[model samples]
Target: MKKRNTCLICLQGLSGSGKTTVANFLASTLNIPVYHSDVERKKLFGLSPTENSSLANLDIYTKEATIRTFQKLYELAFEELSAQQSVLVDAAFLRHHERLRMQQLARDTGALFLIVKCQAGQQIMIDRIRTRQHLGNDPSEASEDLIHKQKQWQEALTSDELQTCIKVFTEEKNWQETLLQRIYRYIS
Candidate 1:
């Protein structure tokens, strides 16, 4: 008997927006694999002790390398989907073009594309980052300066894309519960 193809849920957000946390929860609940870009990159390329390694230095490559990396990831993801496996992609897809490309990937692969945008108050985001840093579990490795830079970029986000994507305002309150419910509703 042929099994049905599973959905592909892409969690897009800024740094420290709980993309990884939410993706982890959703994958665990749905029994799907979470494909984290940073994790996969580290596993594939091995890690470096230098703060600015080759891959991190590639951040200044006009986004061409980043686009290519995502393209390859989509191809790999589609192969898994073809085998009837669900995948949760956790990445900071800050650009509108990246989101559109993922949408196209979903359309081409016949997989459901759920664009989830996780957000939070500035203070809460800063607190989360600090907590993670203190615990030595910060995936973003974003410092205060980096967060400021990210805020500058996010402030430039167009209104149209903000409206289209799912906005999850997670504060110090029941942020996890709200995010879980949103994911459940989208996937179910």
Candidate 2:
């Protein structure tokens, strides 16, 4: 069998947009590993992926902490991509520069890179947030307030970045097959 070049798939979106759901789906269906920044963040505090709300490290959401978290994840991504394993990064990626750096990492590593931009209607996202919080067993730590804050500050993707992104409407459909086939194109 011929070896195909690996891909680095970034699942980027705001909280409650179904990034993790899609990431998990793709990883299971395609046999790829999904690296979630939220889970990793919690691990930094010696917590489990689904710690209680009271245990939430609200103060760790600062700018410096955000940068460090993404940086650490990106380094791990680079290593996995270099080893020829297609990997998924599930994160909000609120910063355009952070997304850019990952794109450049793929370019430098000779790995195919694609951004799966998850989006849903505002009300849907809000509802999902409430549902996830109510359930309290998911890895995400976003509150309704943080969702609003993200809406205020989330940097829209640049035109250049959009060129490499495949938008997934979480409210509408399960897009795993389309995403899988697209990534295959990069490998082929």
Candidate 3:
């Protein structure tokens, strides 16, 4: 039997879009390690959720910090990939450039690049965010303002990007079935 090459599955979406949940499920089903960008950022920078929210509201310096965080994430991800380990990366990844960088990294490493875009209705997303905030278990770094900004960012996603990526959906259909089908297809 041939061993499967490393796969870098990236979960991208707006706040409350269920990216983290899907990524976690997929990682468990696929038996791959998961790398959450927000968790890595917090670990590397000692950034608590409140501090991350504050940074997101900032204008200039935050961009520098974000870049540094992404660089470290890429470094860690590459190290894992080098060991031929499958990994799932859970991140909002709202920037086109960041996505392109990951694609390049995938090509350079000869790893499979799977982009999973999670989507949901705006109202549903808002409700989920509110519930998460109330429960105080949301690991996302987004605040209310950040969530609003993310919705705006998602609205502007290009159709071309959507077409290229796999969408294991959560909108109108049964999320569990859709996710299961996607995992089945990926592993087979």
Off by over 4 Å in 3: 47-61, 151-164, 171-173
Clashing pairs for model 3 are none
Candidate 3 per-residue C-alpha lDDT over 1-188 given as tens digits, one digit per residue, 9 for 90 to 100: 01467777788888778888888878777788887776766666565543454545543227776797778768877887888876788888888877777777777888877788888877777788788767765556555567677666654446755544777556655787776676556545
Best by TM-score: 2
- Segments in model 1 whose C-alpha atoms lie over 4 Å from true places: 1-5, 48-65, 154-164
TM-score of 1: 0.75
Q: Residue 61 lDDT in model 1?
A: 24
* Candidate 1 per-residue lDDT over residues 22-129, each given as its tens digit: 778777777888777665544343443223334465442235545655775677678777777767788777766766677677667777667667777667677887
User: What pairs collide in candidate 1?
Assistant: none
Q: In terms of lDDT, which candidate is strongest?
A: 2
Order candidates by TM-score, high to low.
Answer: 2, 3, 1
TM-score of every model versus the real structure = 0.75, 0.90, 0.82
**lDDT for position 114 in model 3:** 76
The CA lDDT of each predicted structure is 0.65, 0.82, 0.72
lDDT of 1 at 107: 68
Query: Candidate 2's residue-wise lDDT over 1-188, tens digit each?
Result: 02567778898988888899999988887788788998887776667889853556356667777877898889889888888777889999878888989999989988777889998888889899899889988878788787788888789989888878888887775467676676566556
* Candidate with better lDDT, 1 vs 2: 2
Model 1, total clashes? 0
